[model samples]
Target: MELTVTPAALDCFRQEWAFGDGEHIRVFVRYITEGDPPFAFGITRDTPSDAALTTVAGSLTFFMERKDVWFLQGNRLTIDCLGEDIVFQLL
Candidate 1:
């Protein structure tokens, strides 16, 4: 439950996904391990997915694929498959 992403990165995401009352933008992350640089890669597609969006305590969660679910906050995101190994801090 750690956070990665710089202020700039957060800004980029905010600007990129400025949803105006339609559907909440969902952030989906997956586990992609590479040699010497094992990390959880990010897949940000503008189009919506089959994943359902549920709001809890002001946090929008995508509970479709638990194996690769990305607990997101604003532009800040954290994936757990890597045991908090990979960080995508906006930078």
Candidate 2:
């Protein structure tokens, strides 16, 4: 599985990544909504966990759930901060 973090996304992450000490951005998949895209993404601060698969791009670090790896494979996505929403564009 692979993910692409664009320059715009990286800048946004840098601005919002204010977790203290050892905490970092954790990207997780949630099945909360039943819409066109069945899965929802979440980004939050968390300490490194044994189950998380780690990936780093530029200055940003991402922790993804092992189970979510299959879905993310071959998907190139861009994260853009539009007001209060973090929009993911599939490229």
Candidate 3:
């Protein structure tokens, strides 16, 4: 598994969220019964406890927890900005 954060996204995080270097960002799965995909991904500034995968993009660290591996396995995850919002793409 790999994680990529675009420069635009990094800039958004820095300016909007005040995230600094060495900060830990978590990507996790969220179940939504009303959603088209039935599930969605969410991001947050969090500390690693039982991270199954980790990657560095720019000055920030992005990680997925052990329980979230099922959603991330065998995929390349990219964090990009669409307007002022953060978007997650799995490829």
Model 1, which residues run further than 4 Å from truth? 2-10, 14-23, 31-33, 45-64, 69-87
User: Model 2, which residues run further than 4 Å from truth?
Assistant: 16-23, 50-53
Supply the global lDDT for candidate 2: 0.63
Sort by TM-score, top down from the best: 3, 2, 1
TM-scores for every predicted model:
0.33, 0.65, 0.89
Candidate 3: tens digits of C-alpha lDDT, residues 56-82:
878899899999978866898898988
User: What lDDT tens digits, residue by residue, belong to model 1 across residues 1-91?
Assistant: 3243333433343445442333343445554567544544554434345554333212222222333434443343432222323234422
Clashing pairs in 1: 4-89, 5-89, 5-90, 6-89, 6-90
Best candidate, lDDT-wise? 3
Per-residue lDDT for 1-91 in model 2, tens only?
4555666666666665443333467777778768878887777776555543666667556676666655566675556767545676655
- Model 1 deviation from the true structure expressed as Cα RMSD, one decimal place: 8.8
Q: Estimate every model's Cα lDDT from 0 to 1.
A: 0.38, 0.63, 0.88
Candidate with top TM-score is 3
Cα error, candidate 3, residue 24 (Å): 0.6
